[model samples]
Every structure is written in structure tokens, then in C-alpha cells.
Target: MGYYLMKFFSWVACRFSMEKCNSFGKVLGKLTWIVVPKKRKFMAYDNIIRCLGVDAGEAERIAKASWVQFGPMLMEVLRYPELIKDDYIKKYVTIDGLEYLQEAIDNKQGAVIATSHSDSWELMGAALAQYGVPLVGVAKKQKDSAMDRFINEYRTLVGMHITYTNGVREMFKMIKEGWMIGLITDQDPLWSDGVVLDFFNRKTNCFVGPASIARTQKAPIFHGQIVHRPDGGHHITIYPPIFVDQTKDKKEDIKKATQQIANLLENHIRTHPEDWFWLHDRWKSVREKGLD
Candidate 1:
């Protein structure tokens, strides 16, 4: 049933124009501001307070507005199927740093592209795949296996491949085969796999997967994001590669690489404050432990 629902919505989105879908997104965004639950609202508020050093009232306002942005982000994912063609590329998304990606591909050395949970990230992947880049993404499996399958299908249709987060062996194989890996590096990691890092002026735990993977594979890391312009168009930027020094001290190199990625994410989120998904409990564990 969910599969059919997603497929039907996807078809509807493609049948209409991207502009119409964004118009619907605006209405959905307003509705989400009014309807998100109190508990989730509190979580968002708390996260903002810790990360931004804002008082309760201001945090609440930002959190509410953030939820509004999330509505469009949700719609944007369903809109990915529509963006595979040239018409949609020119109309909605613009690539700013194609040279960097092209250079990496020309070198035949695999690259690690890291992005945060910023505006229409999934759309960024779709656009890259459409542009003829060999892209593969690492994704956590959704609790609902059917929904996961449906999303994987869409990703495949757009020419992006997916490797589950737990498939370390498979990921290594892809990297060895010279496939560029795209990963989201802004989420809080599980306690076992994460290291504490300073983010938004607070010590928060972040996943070390990007650094670990890069160190193991000797890959160059690049930061990229899709920034949503006020006019509803996306500007995708792929920055110059950040190389990890693989010296005798592997652990130190990992820490430095992870910190560099975190710093990049901080700058991106700070620049486009509203476009980020602020509803996540990014500082939850620290707050719960009374450490923030």
C-alpha cells in the first residue's frame, strides 16, 4: 500500500511541473508549523537552545520555522523522480562546481563526497547522477523494509547506487572499483561508533565513518551541498577536495579529517540557517547527561 502511494505521488509530481510541486510544498510547510507534536516541538527547541545559545522563546520560534522547512524537504524527496531530465536541471537545479567533480573522475582515484542534511540533499544526488557522474550513496535502512525498497528503486532509476550502512565490505569493494561515494556526515552517531567533536560551539558526537573510510581507502574528501535559493532554485556546490594525511599515526589523521568535515558542515548550516533540518535531536545525549 505504501509502495503504491509513493509511486502514485511520484507520478503526480512528475506529471506536474517542479514549480507546482514547490508551490504545494509552501502550503505543506505552513501546515507543518501548526501540526507537529508537542514532544517533537520540545526536542527541536532544546536542540536549538544548545546549539545556538538562544533562549527558550527564540529557540521555539526557530524550531517551529525549521519544521516548516522540513515539509518542503519531504516533498522535495518525492520530487526527485521529476529531476532526471535536462529541462528540470535548467529549471530547478544548478551545478556550481562541476570542474572539481570532473577532475576527480578524470583522475580515476575514488573521491568521498560529504554533505549535510541541508536543502534537498537527495535531489543533489539525483542531479549528480543525471549529470553522468558515477555516484553511490550510503544509507541507513529504514525500519520499514518496503519503504526502503521503494526509495532504493527511485535512487536506482536516477542512476545512483546504494550500499547499506552496515555493508562495510561492499562499500570497500565499490571504492576499490573506483566508485565515488556520497555520504551525509551531519547526523549524531551511535555511541559506539561516534567521537565527540565541537559543533555549533558545543561538544557533540559525530559519526567517524567518513574519516575511517577515507583513511582506509586513501581517498580524497570533498564537501558538497545543495543550497535552496529564496526563489526556490537549488545551487549545488562541490568544494575542492580535503585530503586526509595518512601518516604513521592513523588515529590522529582520522580525528583531523572528521573535524574538517564537521567544520565544513557548521559553516554550511550557519550560512543557510533556515534550510537545515533543525528538528533533529542533535544534542540530545549531551543534554540528557547534563553535559551541554
Candidate 2:
């Protein structure tokens, strides 16, 4: 089932322009928003309401848009083969701060790209790779093996390196070899592995790997975001590096860097309410352990 779906999407991506693919994706997104189970719908709405401090009606609107956004995002990813040829970075994406990332690369210590599951994150790595950045994207494998291979194939096709969710030690090794590692640390982590952190005014389990990597390797961490634009293109902003404090207090340094990451994530979600992956139960750890 997953393989056939991948084939179908890849065919559509090859046969259609990005605009047409996006239009189809918008329709698919709307259908998904309508047909998704109540649990998912409720979780999205609840998260938006609590995190954004919006009323139910407003939250519902944002939640629907959130689901819809994923459609185009996936389509864009599927169209990567075409995008790679057309110089999409120059034609489609408006970059705000390339120099910051270049600076990280120039420093020769490798770098950590602190990004999240926002907009076309897959494309983010692809774009960086196209621009000659040694980008290694950390991804969660899909439940189905076929689907996982399908996704990773597209990643490698566009020159982005792949590592599984549990590849932190591998990430460090790559960093030592001067590779820029991208970590999507926005989602919920294992209860035992994550540290408690304040996100959107609530306590939740947060992955400190990005912070840990930067602190241990003395690599600079650069926070970045990608968002859809009104012109049917995308905008990417690579912020300046967030240097970790080497105060001989490893725990405190990781905590502070992770908190800074959490703060950046909250600000991004607030600014682009509909672009985030709200379908994930981001605060499940807090709720289950009664941390809130």
C-alpha cells in the first residue's frame, strides 16, 4: 500500500508542475482534515488552543489550515527531482540569511542546524545540500519499511544525507568530519531520555541533542525556519549561530541551549500558527507524567 502510494505521488510529481501538484495537495489536505480521526482532530485543536491561547473557533481554523499546509509541503518534497534541476533555490525560495550558515561552514568545526518540523523541512536540507552545504538531516523512520526507504531515497536523490532518529553518536562523528548536521528537535522525545523544559508556557519533554552536540564539539548552532509565502513560493531564514556557554558546567550549558531552542520554537509557532505540525501530541510526556 505504501509503495503504491509512493509510486502514485512520484508519478504525479514528475508529470505535473509544482503549482498543479500544490493545487491537488490542497484538495487532498482538505479531505484529510475532514476524514482524520477525532483523536487527531481533537489533539490538534487542543494543542493550538492551549499553546496559542486562542478560543476554540480560532484554534479550529488554525488546525484546519495546519492540516492543509502539509499537503503542499509533501507535494513540494515529491517534486524535488524537478526542483533540483530548475535551480529552485534561486527561482522558488527566497533566502534571508545564507551568510550565517556559510560562516558556520567556514569555521571548519562543522555546525548544527537547529530546525523543526515546519514547512518543507525535507526541502530545507535538500536546498542546503544543493548550495554545497554538507547537510546531514536527522529523520524519524516511518513505521512501514517500504515507506521509510521510499522517503530516504528521495532525500539522497537530492543530495541530503540521512541518519535515523537514534543517530546522535553518529551525528557527532559526522560533525568531527566537518559535516553540518540538521536536527528537528521540535517533537516529543522518550520520557526517560528527554529533559523537562518549558514550551509555550507548559512543561514538556525536550531533546537536548542539538545543544549537547554543539557544547561537546564546540560547534555553533544556527536556528533556521522555512515558511510558505503568499507568492506560492517558500522563504528560508537561517539565523545567526547560538553559541553554547562553556562554563565547565555541562548540564547547565545543555539546559540553557535547549531552553533557547525551545524559546525559538515557541516564537516560530506563534508567528506562523498554521505552519507547525500540531497533529503531534507535543506535550504527551507532560500529561502522562503529570508534569504540568
Candidate 3:
């Protein structure tokens, strides 16, 4: 069932221009917003109010747009086989911060791309790789094995390597081989070992994997943020490389770096709040544990 759904979506994506495909995504997103459970819908709307302190009306609007945005972005994932070309990405997406990315790559130490669920993140990595940057991003596999394989194959087709969720060993190994690692650092986590950081002025558990790896490997870091323009295109910004403080205590340094990454994420999300994936309860840890 998953396999056929995947094929259907992929075929539909290939049948149209990127803009047209995105229009289809918008329609699907609207349908999903209507059909998905009502409780979950308000949960997201409430989350925006809690995190961003937006009024109920504005939060509701953002939450609705969030649902609509994902459909089109997921289409870009399916269209990877054709969309990962330099001409195509350049045509529809404008990329900045090349010098920062190049600076990270130039450093002998491998670099970690600290990116959040900003815009079409799949397209973010693919667009960079299409321009001759060798990148590898981690993915969470689908429950259906066939669908998982299909998705990863398209990711690789975009010229980025894959490390499945919890592929820590694979991630480090790829870094050792000089591959620039792209880590999605914005998932809500509940691990006791996770670091606590201020997200939108509220305390929550945050992923320390990128910072921990940066300190141990002496790698520089860059925050990748993308925004979908009103003109139906995307603009990607790669902030400058942040080198960790190995000279300080490892634990303290990791916490500081994580906080800095948090700052980057918060800034981007604040600027383009609608572009973020706000449906998930990112503050779940804070709510459940009370800033412990």
C-alpha cells in the first residue's frame, strides 16, 4: 500500500513543473487540514501560542499554513530524481552563504550542518549537493520497508548520502570520509541526557548530537535556514561556521554550543514562523518535565 502511494505521488510530481506540483501540494495540504483530527489541530494552534506567544487568531493561521506547506515540500522530495539538477534548483531556488559553507568544507576538520525543520529541508540539502557540494543527511525511515527504501533511493539520487535514524555510527563514519554532515537538530526529545535550552523563551530538551560531535571532531558548524518566497520559490541561507570551544570543559562547551544553535533556530523560526513545522509538540519535554 505504501509502495503504490509512493509511486503515485512520484508519478504525479514528474508530470508537472515544480510550481504546478507545489499547487497540487497546497490542495492536498488543505484537504489534510480538514480530515486530520480536530484535537490535534488545536493542539498545534495552542503550541504556537505557548511558544511564540502569538494571539489565538494568529497562531491558528500559522498552524493552518504549516499544514499546507508540508504537502508541497513533500512533493519536492518525490520529485528529487528530476529536481536535483543545477539548472532546476537554480531556476527555482536562490542560495546564499556559499562562502560560509565552503569555509566549513575547507577546514580540515569535517563540518556539521545544524539545520532545523526549516522550509523544504529535503530540497535544502539537494539544492546544495546539486551545485557540487557533497552532503549527507540523516533520515527517519517510514514504517513500511518498501517506502523507506524508495525515499532513501531518491535522497541518494539527489547526490546526498543517507544515514537512517539512530545511525550514529554511520554518521561519524561518513564524516571520517570527509562528507559534510547535515543534522536535523529540531526534533522534540525526551532523553534524560539531552541538554536543556531556551526555545522561544521556554526551557526544553534539545539535541546535543551535533555539538557533541563538533567538539570531539573539531568540526566547524553552520546553521542552514530556508524560506519559501512569496514568488513560489525558495531562498536558502547558510550562516557562518561556528567553531566549538575545545579549550573549555567538554560538557559546558557542548551546552554552550547547543544554546547557540538554539539561538539560531529561534531567530529563524521567529522570522519565518509559518515556514516551521509547528504541528508537533516541540515543547513536550518542557510541559511534561517542567524544565528539569
Candidate 4:
């Protein structure tokens, strides 16, 4: 069944032009509005409400627009094997602050590249891998074993490496071998290990893994974002290096650096409200505790 489904999807993808795929995405977006349960929609709306506060109305518009963008985004993922081969993909994605990445590589020190679940994030990893950068991405295992296997195989097809969330040791080993680690740090962290930080002007628990690893390994940290362009393409902006200072107080350094990253994330989301994933309960833990 999986083999047949994959082949069918591949055939459909091959037959459709990029413009046709985008038009189909618009139709899919409308279908999603009809099919997605009201409860789920309300939850997404509520999350956006909290994040945008007084601008909730505007946020809702952007969130809904994101559903449209997300459809094409997923289709792009399905078509990635062909998309990566085209030189024009470079025109859509502009990488800033690459010199900082080069500096870290030249120093023989592996670095951590942190991004969020923003616009077409998977493409960003594929681009780096295509340039022969030993990029390893950490991801949570999907619930369906078969689906997880399929997605992993697809990623590897484009030359990107994957490390499951449970494999901390493997991630450490990859870094030690001078492979750059790409992590999505915007998700709500598990309660025990996360620190409450201010995100979108509200208190939220954020994962400290990126900061922790950077400080421990004395590695340079770079922030990057894949912004959705008006022309239906993406622009990948890489920010300057956010070096983790290894002071005497390691915990303090981790907290400070993590907060810095959170601040940057907040600013980006503010500027491009529609490009972010607003469906997740990012502030749930704090709000549940009556802290927010």
C-alpha cells in the first residue's frame, strides 16, 4: 500500500506544473476550512489571539492565509527532489551571514544552526546539504512508523541526515565529527527541561537545548529564517552569529543566550505574522499555570 501510494503521489507531482500545484493548493486551503474540525480551528484561533494580543484580528487573517501557503508548502516538499536540482531555487532563497558559517567551518569547529517551523523550512536544510555542508537535522519521530520511515527516506534522498529526538548521544557524536547541527527551537519544550521565557510578550517555556549544546561544545550559533516572498518563492535570511559565552556560570549563559534567540524569533514572527506556525500551543504550559 505504501509503495503504491508513493508511486501515485510521485506521478501526480510529475504531471503538475508549479503554477498548477499552487492553484491546487488554493483549492485545498478552502477544502481544509470545510474539513478541519471547528474545535481545532478555535484552538488555532485562540493560540493566535494570545500571541498577537491587541492585533488578534490581524493575526487571524494571517493565520488563515498561512493555511493557503501551507498547502503549496507541503506540495513543495513532495516535489523537493526535483526542485533542489534547479539553479533558480537559489534566486528564491538568499542566504545572508553565510560568511559567519564559513568562519566557523574554517576554524574546524562544528556549529549549531537554529531555525523555526517557518516557511518551507525543509528546503533550507536541503539547500545547505546540497552545498556539501555536513548537515544533521533533529526531528521528533512521527506516530506512524511507516510514515516516519517514508519521510526519513525522502529527506535522505536529498542528502540531508536525520537524528531522532531520543538520540542525544548520536547528535553529540555528529557534532564531534564536525557536522553542523540544524535544530528547530520554536516548539514548546517538554516541561521538565524547559525554562519559561517571554515570547510574543507572554511567558512561555522554551527548549534550552541549542544554548546548552553550544555552551558545552563552545560552538558558534547562527539564526536563520525562510521568509515567504510575494512572488510565491522563499527568501532564506541567515542572521549573524550569536556566540554562546562560556562564562563561569554555565546556567546563566544558557538562559541569557536562549532568551536572545527567543527575542530574535519574536521579532521575526512579528514582521511576518503569516509565515509562522500558530497552531501549536506554544504558550500552553505557562497559561495553564495561571502565569501568563
Clashing pairs in 3: none
The lDDT of model 1 is 0.80
Candidate 3 residue lDDT tens string, 43-136: 8888788778889999989988987888898888888767755478776778789777776557544689889886888788888887666688
lDDT of 3 at 37: 80
Candidate 2 regions with alpha-carbon error over 4 angstroms? 1-5
Choose the strongest candidate by lDDT.
Answer: 2
Candidate 1: worst-modelled 10 consecutive residues by lDDT: 82-91
Badly placed stretches (over 4 Å) of model 1 are 53-58, 288-290
Instruction: Put down candidate 4 lDDT per residue, 1-292, tens digits, no spaces.
Output: 7745765675687577766777787788767866766666677777777767746576667767766666777676677666666664566556766777777777777888999988778778876676666788887898877667767777787778999988888888878878888999998877777898877777889889889888888787788888867787777777888888778998889989999999999999878877887766677777788987
TM-score of model 2 vs. true structure: 0.95
Q: Which 10 residues in a row give candidate 2 its minimum summed lDDT?
A: 86-95
C-alpha lDDT values of all predictions: 0.80, 0.86, 0.82, 0.78
How well does model 4 score by local distance difference test? Answer: 0.78
Off by over 4 Å in 3: none
What are the models' TM-scores?
0.92, 0.95, 0.94, 0.92
On residues 178-258, what C-alpha lDDT tens digit does candidate 1 reach at each position?
778888888767777777878888988887887888889998888898887768888899888888888999878888888
Best by TM-score: 2
lDDT of 1 at 121: 81
